[model samples]
Target chain A: MLKKHNILVVEDELELAKSTLAYLTENGFSPFHAKDLKSARKLLKQENFSAVLLDLGLPDGDGMALIKEIKNAKNEIGLIIVSAKDALDKKIEGLELGADDYLTKPYFFPELNARLKSVIRRLNLEVNQEIILNEITLLPEQMRTLIHGEELELTAKEFGLLLYFVSNQNRVISKTTLGEFMSSNYADYGFTDDMVYTHIKNLKKKLSGSGCDDYIKNVYGVGYKFTVA
Target chain B: MKLLTKTSLNFISASVLFFLVGSMAMYFSVRNIMAEDLRNRLLQQQNEFIYTAQQNKVMDLVSELVFVQTTQNKQLYSFSDTVLITNEKYMLYRKLDFSYAQNEQDYKVSILLSQSESDKLIMKIAIMNIGFAMLFFLIMFFVNRHSIKSALGVFYSTIRKLEDFEVTQSSTLSLDTAEIEEVKKLNQVFEKMSAQIRKDFISQKEYTENVSHELQTPLAIISSKADELMQADNLSKEQMEQLALLLETTNRLSKINQALIFLTKIDNRFYTEGSTFSLNDLIKEKLSLFKDAIQDKNIKLKLDLLDITHVYMNPYLAETLIINLIKNAIFHNKSGGVLRITLSNNTLSIANSGGSLSFSEKDIFKRFTRSSENKKSLGIGLSIVQRICDLYSFNIAYSYADEHQFKINFKK
Candidate 1:
């Protein structure tokens, strides 16, 4: 049995925090919730968290105040700033204060999941060198993939889409979610439904042609799902 | 006209008018007084001549200035002007004529006085008056000009400060104190206005950020809830499709909101920090981000970098400007259409082989003016592009002949 990594979600809104906590728990993390900066600080002192999803606007104070404290206490802890203020200066400031990543609000859960996993994997490089799903093995550190112990050729974008799906398996990802993922991850402005479809088609073809089981499935003409079973 | 110039002109014109009128009045008054004195002396000399004639013979009283002549009838005393030629020079005289009887003989006596002496005195007085009055006016002209210039010192400084004032900056407008009441009042009004504007600007900025936070947090909640619902099993196809639609609409609304905030920030001149970089490298870098989309659409990209043009701009805005333009060209292009980009002589031209706009060409850059068929486009990309260009005063033009083209001139 694998040990569940502890995740801390610092958000002021109760409903948002509830949904995020539920999502994190379902994704195999031991999630804890804090509605304000004081409670978040108390929670941090009580538990050793593997990652933190910080909301910048807190009731008592700015979430930026806690960034330095959290970073100085531990370097291995993965911190991501989840802010509604998408200003460039704010993003730069958060990153400069040792935040592992920055995610604007109204983010897709799948995107968040992928980024959180990537941040953890990066922090614990030796422990998580590869992601193995049956015959398919993914070396995320090198952007390398193999099926039946043989190397698979994939483009950078194709690899990113596959990693996103693998990180969030057994759940339906809407076309809009996939489009936004492509747009935000690649910093591309105009990502259309057709582009996402084309990229997914190519990635699925490459995966199946390599004598690998078809894990990715199309769902109800609206979205795609990567079914592990 | 400048205030100083206008005031100085008025002062000069008034002094000239008053000086002219005063000199004329002084000259006439002096001449009148001299004429009256000459008349009074003439009367006194007539008395003297009559007394002398009574004592001696009337003919003996006749001298160089006095003349006696026998007359048939007695003439009442009268004064008249007479001209006499002496030493070949014309001389004007005021003469008094009277009739007298001496020892039963009737005689006419004439007494003459030269008027040239009083005329010379009047001229001297008139000249002296003009000289003194001119000196006084000249001194007053300089003093008036200097006083006005000094008083308006604070006013000119106020104008200069206004010219340099930028609402985006955080500094408050502070004006110098003035001795002049009108200028002091003007400065007070200006300072009050600037402070109000700053307050409004700050509140507006806060409002924009607040709106983003207020709307985005709810959107996040909705999206997260819908995503959570998607994990449920035993759901019908219709329910799943509806959930997908809900999530997509929520995402769309969030995007529109964020884009609007970005547009407002640009309008408010929020991005001010800048650096110089090469356009060629930036284009290549941004194009790589859209390579997959270009490949997916099978658009043939033609790049002609004739020069390594460098531009000084906010790097983030520069990136956005190029990305938005290229994305528009590629996104709007037909399948297998040619996307041509050429840069030279501080100009960039991006052309795409796409069908003509369904709407008016003039409306192409307007926000939310997309074709009915292409609902995926946010329609704010071109507007953002135009705004960034407008910020830097770059000339941007859109045209369509055989293909849709966007041209930008970096230099004005």
Candidate 2:
């Protein structure tokens, strides 16, 4: 059995922290929450965490200080700043202080999941980089995929969407979430619902044609769910 | 007229009028006093002639300047001016005629006094008066001009400093000290006003940032909660669709809030850091960002870069200016529409194939004015573009012939 990753969510907003913690738990990770910088510091000392989702604004102090603390420690812990401020300077400063990634507020859980997993993957270099679900094998680093021991061709955007789906499986992802993800990762283009629909259709066609079991299913005509069962 | 010139002119004109009237009065008064002395001398001479005629013969007393005339009737004393020819030159005299009774006979006695010396004295006095007045006026003109200029020194400096004052600058407005009461009061008022303005400006900036922070946290919470509810398997299709709508509405609201904050920042001149860069390269780079959208819409892009124009502006604003314009053009375009961009002679023209607006053309750049078909558009892009152009004094125009066209003139 694979060991679960320990994630720390540092947020001041109680409701937001509760939702984030629940989301983290549902994604197969052991999660801890700290509502302020003082408690966060205490939690950091008592536990071993693989990654931290740090909100820049905390009750006691700024989360930027925690970024430095985590980076300076002997153990490697992935740091991701989740800030309400979309200020460019703050983003640059967080990254410069050893944060692995940054996410603006009102973020999608799937988006956060992808960034957290990517950060953890980067920090643990010896961990296997391939994601496998039965007949499907995805080599994320090389952007290559295989089904039943046969190479499958996918475009860059298709490969990105597949990776996003695999990371966030069995959950209904809304079209708005998918659209935001597509626009942010791709050229910041206005990704319409039709465009997202087309890309998913093409990706689904390619996956089924390669003799792989269909994993992606539409949920109530509102969203798509990548079911692995 | 300048204040100094105005004051100096007034002083000079007043002095001239006073000098003219004073010299004339001095001349008349001096002539009267000299004529009175001459009349007294002539009277004393007439008294001496009457005594001489009483003692001796009255005709003998009339020599060169004296004259005795025999008259049938006695005359009262009188003085008259007479001219005599001596050595063929006319000489003026003051003569007094009086009647005298000597040796039981009536005699008319006349005494003459030369008036040339007194006339010469009056001329000297008039010349002296004028000379002294002119000198006094010249001195007063210089002193008056210098005093006024010195008094207004603080006022001029205040004006110069005000001309260079920018609210974005972090320095306080400090004015020079003044001896003049009015100028001192004026400086105090100005200093107080500037301080108030700075305080208001700083508070306004903080309010904008605080609003963004305060609202975004709740939005984040709401969105997360809705996203969680959507994850439930027991929800019906109607519930799921409603959840989706709620999420999209939250997202839209957040976008509108952010756009308003950004507009306020631009209006407040927040992005003042500047650099010089090539517009052509910037357009090309931004176009690459929209390449997928263009392909999705099947937009036929026609780009003509006739020159490498280097524009000096805040790099962030420049990027926004180009992005907003390009986004507006692409998003409003129809399927299989032609998107044409041309840059030449310090001008940029972006045209897209779209039908004429259902609304008024003048309202195109107004905020929140969008077509009925594209309800998804935020409608603030063109407004932001117009604001940035206005900040730099660039001329922006929108026109429609066969397509919607936006042209910008970058020349000052």
Q: Indicate which candidate wins on DockQ.
A: 1
- DockQ computed for model 2 against the true two-chain complex using alpha carbons: 0.66
Off by more than 4 A, model 1: B35-120, B149-156, B177-186, B304-310, B344-346
Query: Candidate 2, residues B1-412: lDDT per residue as tens digits?
Result: 8888888989988888888888888888999999999999987887777666667888777789988887666765888999998999899999888888777778777788999999899988888888888888889889888888888999999999889888888998999998999999999999999999989999999899888888888999998999999998799999999999888888888888888888888888988888899999999999998887889999999999999999988888899899888988888888999999999999999999977798899999999989998878888889999999998999999999989999999886
> DockQ values for all predictions?
0.74, 0.66
The TM-score each candidate achieves on chain A is 0.98, 0.96
Whole-model lDDT, candidate 2? 0.89
lDDT of 1 by residue, B1-412 (tens): 9999999899888888988887888888888899899999999999888777767888887799898889877865789989899999999999988889988778888899999999789888888887888899889989998998898999999999999989999899999999999999999999999999999999999999999999999999999999889878887899999999999999999989999999999988899999999999999999888887788788999999999999999999999999999999988999999999999999999999988889999999999999888887888999999999999999999999989999999986
CA shift at A22, candidate 1, in angstroms?
A: 1.6
Write model 1 residue lDDT over A63-82, tens digit each, in one string: 99999999898888899999
CAPRI-style docking class of model 2 based on DockQ: medium
Model 2: how far residue B312 lies from native, Å: 2.0
